[model samples]
Target: MQTPVHGSLLKPLQVNEAVGVWFHFSHSGSTALPHLPADILKWSKNYQNITYGVLDTPFQTVTTYANNSCLLLLDGRIDNLATLNDAYQISDPSVQSVVWYLYVTFGIKGFYRLKGRFTLVLYSVESEKTMLYRPYLSGFPLYYQSQEGGYTLSTNPLQLCDTKNSVTPLDKQRVAHYFTADPLKFSSHPFHSLSKLEPGEIVLMDAEGVEKIRQPVHEAFPKQAIPTQKDAIYRAYRRLIETAVSETLREDIDYGIMLSSGIDSATLAYHASKLLSKRGKKLIAYSWKLPNDAADESEKVKALCETLEIELKLLSAEGMGPFDEVGSMAYNPGSPVTNAFARLNRECYKLASRDGIKYLLNGNFGDMLFKYGQPKLTELWKERQFGQLLLALKRVSKKVIPAETQVRTPWLTDEVKSLRKEKTHSETGKTDYRYALCDFHEDYFGGERYLSGVYGITRLEPHRNSALVNFCLQLPQTLHS
Candidate 1:
C-alpha cells in the first residue's frame, strides 16, 4: 500500500531558500479566504502557489499526510535527529516527518520532547483543529490573529496585517512593557489585533475557539543528579557543548560563526571549526570592529580565528550608534526593536548572506546557562550575608563584579509603572532560575531572529539546546554560582 504524503512524509527544499508558512482557518466554514497583501501573495507565489489549506513560499516546504487529513509546517532546524530516530525507530528522518510522527503518536504532548529552535504548525483537516507550538527559549517567531468566526496564522506577523481592512492598532500595554520590564519580556505582540506565541506555549484553534496553553514553570526544569568533582563537571559541560555544535552543523548548507572575544562565541567557534574541518570545510567567522574604542576585541578575535584556521570577516561599526537605521530596523521586525546593536547585527547577517552563508551560529544564552550569580552575591554582600556569600564564592569565582543598575523608564506613566511593578513581582517570585533565564533569552533573541530572516539567514544558537539547558539547570548550585 502506498503511504499518504502529508501526515507521515516530508518534501525537502533547497538549502538557500527562506522558509515560512501561512494559512487561514474559518470557524464559520466560510469559503472566502482572508485577504493577503499583494506583495505577500507575490512573494509566496515565487516558491509555491497558494492553496486553500496551505500558503507557502519557495523558502519553505509543506507536506500533507493521512490522505490530506493533516498538514504540517515547520520553520527552523531540528537538533535531535539521532535521539528522535532512535526513539521513533525511524531512519533518516526529516524535521517535518519527525514532528508529524511525534504528533501522530503522542499528540500535543509530543512537542515537549522536541529540543531545538523551531515554530511548528499542525492542522488536522478531518477534525478542523489547528495546533501551533514553539519550544521553550526558541527564537523563531510565530504570530496569529483572531477575527470574527475565524483566525489566521503566519511566521511573519506583518503578513497578518490586512491593509484593506481597518488599520491595525498598537498594543499600548506591550509597548509600555517593552520600555519598563526587566529582561524585556514580550509575551504579546506590539499590534492589538495580532498575538505572538510565547516560548513553551501552545495554541489550539477549532470550532470551539482558541485556547492557549503554557508549560508549567516547575515541569520545565526537572531536577537532575550532577557530578561533584570539578573535572567531571567540566567534562560533562564540554560534552554537551560539543554535541550542540555538532548537531546544529549541517553538511547541506554553508555556515559561519559570529565570533566574539568572549568564551561563549569562542567556544562555539572552536567546536564548529573542528566539526567542519573533518568535512574538508573552513569555518567563516564574523566579528564587529569598533574603531577607536578601547573595548574593541577585534585583535583577540583575529588571533583566535587564526589559531582555528578559520577565515575572519571583520565589519567596522566605527561610528554606528543605536539610533542609526532606526526607521528601517523598526519597520522590518514587525514589532518594537529592542536590541541596541540590531543595526550592526543586521549588517553582519547581510555580509554573511553575500558570502553565501546560510546558517549563522552564535553563543547566545551561554552566560545564562552557566550563570555566575553575581547579582545575588552582590545582594548577599549588601545584606551582610557573609556565610552565603562565602559559599557562593566557592562554587563560582572569588571575584565579585558590581551589579549594573536597572534600566530606567523615565517617561513611564502611572499606569505603566503599576504594570511594571506587577510584572517585576511575578518574575522575581519564580523559583526556577533556569526557566526565567530562558524567558529572558527568548525575548532578547526573538527580534534578532526576525532581523536575520530579512537577509535570508537562519540564526543558530547552540547554547539554547534543551539537553544543554537541562544539564546546566541540574548542575549543583555551586557550579552554577
Candidate 2:
C-alpha cells in the first residue's frame, strides 16, 4: 500500500479547530486505506478517541453504517434535523447519524431533502464505489484529483497532492482568468491538478473512472411571480428575512454579527438583536474601523448597535497593512486569496475568537441577492426597451454601464487569453438573473466558509437562505433599488 502523504508545500494554518476529510481509492483491488497527516492523526487521537478508519474533527464527524458496508464523512449542520429525527424516531441524533440513515435508506437522492451548508463523502466497501456530494448553497469545499489507478478526494486541495513529488505547479490559465475575469465567477484553484466540486455537484467514482452530476441552477433558484405591489413585496421580504434570521439563531450558544454602516449588516443586526432580546440574551456586533477615519463606518455601526440594544465591538485596522499575514491567509483556503479585504476579515474573525464566540453571522451576500441593479439595465437593453433603459440609467450611476476594463495583467500573452473560457449565460439562461448571480458568486461563499473554519467559527449568512434568495430574485428590479 502506497501511503499518500499530505503535501507539505501548502501548509495549513494553525486553527483552533478545522474539519477535513482525505481518502484515496484504488481500482487495482488494494484494500489499504490512505494514511492521514501526522497532525490530523494526533488530533484525532487526543480529541476524537477513534481508532483506524474513523477520524473526527471538532466541527465534523465520520460515521460508518449499513453494517460497516458504508462510511460517511460529514461537515456542517443539518437544518432539518427536527424533521429527520421525527421520521427516524431517533433521539439525540448527530448530523452524521441522521445523514447516514438518510443515505442508507434513500441513496443519493436523499440528499435533496437536506437543507443546510454541508459537504458529504460516502464510500461503499461492498460496491467499491465512492460518492462525493455537495448540496446547493453549500459553501464547504471539496476537491479531488485523479491518479493512475483511481483518485484522491479531500476537503483541502493541498491534501490531494502527493508530497512524493515537488510542489504542484500553479495553473497559469486559471491565474490569468483570475486577473481578467470576474473573481466571483472564476472557480479554478491555483494548483493545476486540483478540481473543485461546484455547489450541488455530485461525483461518483468507480473502477472505470469518475462521473459528475450537477443539480440545475434553475432548480436551485426556481422563479416565482412575486407580486410587484410595494406593500406586498415589503411584507414578503420582511417575513423572509425575519424567518431566516430566527432560523440561524441558536439558543444554547451566543453568536455575533459583522456589522457595517450599510443596510445589509444593519438589517441582520436589527433582526438578530430583536430575536435574541426576547430570550434575555444580548447580540454582539463587530465592526471593522478603517485607520484615520477614512470612510469609516464605526460611528454609524455604533449608533445602530446602540439603538438595537446590542453590544458593539470595534476592531481597528490602524497599523495593519493590506498584506499582513497574507502568506498564511492565502494557504488557509488551499487556494489563492484574491479578495483585498482578506486581512481585515481575518482580524475580525480573530477578535471574535478572543471573545469566546464560535458562531459569527454576516450579511456578506445580501446586496447581491436583494440590491443587485445591473440586471435591470441588462434586461432593458436585451429587450430593446430604450425608453425604459434611459429612465433606468437616470436612476443608476454611469458605473452601472458595462465597459471594457483593462486586465490587471495587461501584458498577458494571446495564448492565456485564448485558454480563458468566459462564463456564458447558457447554463443559467439569459433571463434567469437570480440564478446567474448566485452561480457567479458561488466562490465568494466558499471562500468565507474556509476563512471562518480557520478560527473554528461557523459563519452564518441568513441572506443566503434558499427561500429568501428565491423571493428576492423574484422581486421586480424596481424593488431592488
Candidate 3:
C-alpha cells in the first residue's frame, strides 16, 4: 500500500472534520495545496499527480497503492468485491485492490461495472493519463477545474477555493439558478472554475489539459417498447428496491432512515425495517415535527413506524422556522439554498451525526418515478389538443391545484405573465421527463451536497439508482397515472 505524502508547503490550508478531498495536477512538478481538513486520510504527490482525500462517513478506512507506473486512490464501499476478485484471480480484495486489478486487466472499461458511492482518482505512468470517476447514480460529489497544463479535482468545492494559491470565482449562472424556484436540471457547478462530474461521467487528463473521455454518465430514457404488464412492472420494481436497499445495508454499522408521512419514506422505512429485522437488528427512523401546520405529518409516520416495529425518533422542532439560523448553520461556501426549511433539515442531520449514525436513507426523487407532477396540462394546451386539454385542466382544477393556490389565481396568472417576459432556463422543457431531470439535479444533487457536508453524513437515495430510473422511464406514461 502507498503511504501518505510528507512535508508541508509554504502555507497549508485548514480542513474541516467533515469528509472532503482536494488535489491539483501539474506537469511542472507540483501545485501549491490548501491546508487539508482534519478528516483527510491521505495527501500524496508525485511528478504527475498530487491528491488529497478524506475518509467518507461510512467507508472510513482506505488503502492506497502506488508504484512508479500506477497510482490508485479509493474512498468508499465496493459491493461486487467477490466477483471482481474471482475475475482477477485473486484471494484478497479491497476497493483499492479491485480497482488496481480491474484497471490493469481491462483499462477504462473496469469502471463501468463498479457499484457503490465512491470517488476514485487513478494515474497511470505508462499511459501518461489521469482518470476520475464515480458511480452512475453518484453517491458523492466529484468536481474539477481546468488549469494551464493540467487541472484540479476535489470532492469539496470549498476546499478547492481555500487552497493557498487558488483563484476560483463564483458562477453567476449557477447562483441565479439556485435562487429560482425552477433551476436547470443539467450538470453545473456553483463555482466558475469548477465543474460537476455528472453522473456516470469520466474525464481523462494529460499534460495538454482535461477532456471528457466519454458521453455523460448514465443512460437516457429508452426508445424501445417498455414492459406493458402492470404486474411485471411491479415485480421488477420490487426486485430493484430490494436489491438497492440490500446492497446499501452494511452489517457492521447501524443505519437509519429519514422517515416522513410521504409514501416514499414510508415505503423505504417499511422495507428497511423488514430486511434489517431478519438480521436481528432494529431500524431507527427519524422524523421532524415543525411548528407549521403544513409540516405536520406525524400521524402516518407514527402508524407506519409502529407497524414495522421500527424505532422512531420524533424530533420536536416546534417554533423552528425554515429560515431560522440560516446565517449560522454549517455553511458550505458557494452553496445555494432555495428552501426555508434548510435549518430544520440541518438539525435532523446533526442529531443523526451526533448519535454516530453515518448513513441516512432518504426517499428523494421517489415522486418522479411515478410521474407525480407532470406539466401535461400545460403541454396539452400548448399542443392545442383541445379535448385532452380541457380534460387535463379540469383534472388539474379538481386534484392538482391546491385551495390556497386557487385563492391567488389572478396573482399567479400575473406572475406567470411576468415570468414569460423574462429569459429563464426553467422554461426549457414541457414534458414530465424533462421536469424530473431538472428536479433531480436541483433537489437531489445540489441540495443534498450541502446537507451532507454540514452533518458529515451520507444520504443514500436508492430510488435515484440509474437502473431503477431507466426502468421507470421505459414504462408507459399510462402506468404512471
Best by lDDT: 1
Clashing pairs in 1: 6-64, 6-65, 7-64, 7-65, 18-59, 47-58
| lDDT (0 to 1) per candidate | 0.55, 0.54, 0.52
Worst 10 residues of 3 by lDDT: 419-428
Error of 1 at 328 (Å): 18
- Checking candidate 3 for backbone clashes, the offending pairs are 13-34, 13-35, 15-36, 15-37, 185-438, 200-217, 322-340
Worst 10 residues of 1 by lDDT: 46-55
Error of 3 at 6 (Å): 6.2
Arranged by TM-score with the best first, the candidates are: 2, 1, 3
Q: Give the alpha carbon lDDT tens digit for every residue of 332-408 in model 2.
A: 33444344345566667778888988888874322444332322212221234334433433343223322242211
Off by over 4 Å in 3: 1-18, 27-59, 88-107, 147-149, 163-190, 215-227, 252-254, 292-296, 306-311, 316-338, 353-358, 364-368, 371-438, 441-458, 464-466, 477-481
Model 1 TM: 0.66
Give lDDT tens digits, candidate 3, residues 1-481: 1123432321222323324455567765453333322112133332333444432222233334554455565545566788878876765475556776778787776786677667677776576677887665554566677665556776655544443232222342222223222222223433446666654556677666566533222233334444555445555666776777776776646777776654345556666777887887767878766666564666666766666677778788776555334422233333454444444455567788888887888742223343332232122112343334234334544453344441211112332233221111222232122111323443334345445554667677767566665665444332333
TM-score, every prediction: 0.66, 0.67, 0.64
